[model samples]
Target: MLSTSARLLRLASLLQSRRHWPGAALADALDVEARTLRRDVERLRELGYPVEASSGVGGGYALGRGAALPPLMLDDDEAVALAIALRAASASVGGIEATSLQLMGKLDQLMPQRLRRRATALHAVTLSLRTGTPLVDAGLLSELATACRDGRALRFSYRKHAGETTARHVQPQRLANYGRRWYLIAWDIEREDWRSFRIDRIEGGLQLGDLFAPRPVPPDVAARLERGIAYAPFACRITLRLQGSLEELQAALPLWCGVIEPETTTHSLLRMGAETPEGLLAQVLMIDRAVEVVDADAVASDIGRILARMSSVFSRDGARVAP
Candidate 1:
């Protein structure tokens, strides 16, 4: 037999599972006497769940709408689904990592051993990855999502890649999450062009203006965001001319590493960015064979020292280093 609190929660769940229940049927479902069920209903009403009782031929009890949102219940499947979804939600929110750990533990404890093992494995792999540096303001993300849904025009100061801040008037269209970051694809009202703005770089809270009719979102939204995320927000732009097809180079490099273009049947252009010229060289050196660095001459003075250090390390031993 369930204790008083547990019985009350089960009773609440039963009341919520259907529109109405006959008094005797409800008592049978709860494994309690009719009087005990009435007391439980009264308890729920006192807790602000407005449970209405009807006593006639078709009489029973029904959960009526409350003035405010009262606590609802989730069955096992619903609980597991929500828990899994929350794991992938923004890890960038400050302090949520710890809260997330606590939530995961509580849920895991409630699960049967079979399910708990899977939950344990999931948390073990996800904790470190989920709780690092703070990126997106969860509240701000909600605001942007709301703006997109409401077709609202937004005014916010956006920080550019070069550390310059500019005011923007945008018709909020869509919010894109790519490469573990957030991007807003909207009509730039001032520039009169479509642009992808990284959400983290927005200066502050958005000042929402009057709602406007939504414009047609481009079919290639993800591609545009992929390009922006790959090439933008780096210290300097680096272009590498590699002797391979665009597809080959793309397969060889990470998705956010750079943007690739087909220069010809025999050659391709890879455009990427890094914080420094030497950092670009490091990425290039990752390729086994040599490739032409178009902007190499420009940064020759900067990369000379780096090349010398690398050469000294390799020239020390005639033997090849482990790949």
Candidate 2:
């Protein structure tokens, strides 16, 4: 018979694997009396695992999800799958910051020797097929996230593209990850308006101010922020009636690429802001589908002229022609 501590470890693994188990069934599977099982459950609860219990004949135990995640048990395949996923997430395709990499680091440190070998072999064979770019510091990202979660005001110096530097005091709200970058949506204290700041542009001396209640935000604050980002290049509103499923549209477009309002199950109203006519025209052309450019005629007109010029160039050069 296994010792009590060994039995408890096995029980924890079993419980985590099955997710939920009837009290009697679990006791039988562990080859222990129901009373022993009860003690083990108590021990698990004492160890900070929220093992919820239900009453009645079908009563059982299950773990409750929480903000502070508990240690997870994974088999060989599961571990390999997680490592591969983390490697992909670390790449530029998804705006996933080094958070996934940090978690992977933790996982690697805790992995057993055999599992570590397996992870290493998997990583050696797996190719990301992506060119990684220098990203914002993970330590800074963690600090900003902590400040946001604590509802603390932040002070950071920011640099603009034109080499202008300014100090900012903001009530940090949400940290949004978009294609290779992290953006913070915060209430700019000095400007007296909500503004978005790039994590890459933020300098040191980021102090967390006194905690305060977070301001009410929209149900889809991310979507709104995405619209702002996608349209930031233009000083005008550009509308398009997209002819695709919401999932399809969202999959093709980044969360910060456009302001997508669900029009129906099959389509959505996408409004993108642009700072220039040329930039606005290029945004629509990227869709390259049967989308009707609606709001600003300047965008449609410019796109039409651009496409016509392209058509002439292709005809002259005898390049691959669009049907």
TM-scores, all models, native as reference = 0.61, 0.68
What does the lDDT come to for candidate 2?
Answer: 0.77
lDDT of 2 by residue, 170-283 (tens): 999889987777888899988988888878889865977888887986676776677657665456567879888777888888654477778888888888766666666666
Clash pairs detected, candidate 1: none
Instruction: Give the poorly placed runs of model 2, Cα more than 4 Å off.
Output: 1-6, 14-31, 38-72, 75-78, 89-132, 160-164, 252-257, 273-283, 315-323
lDDT of 1 by residue, 133-196 (tens): 7678777888899999999999999998879999999998988876567888999988888899
Per-residue lDDT value at 162 in model 2 = 47
Candidate 2: residue pairs that collide? 226-256, 231-273, 233-274, 233-275, 234-274, 234-275, 234-276, 235-274, 235-275
Provide the clashing-pair count of each candidate structure: 0, 9
Q: How far does residue 90 in candidate 2 sit from its true spot (Å)?
A: 4.4
Top-TM-score candidate index? 2
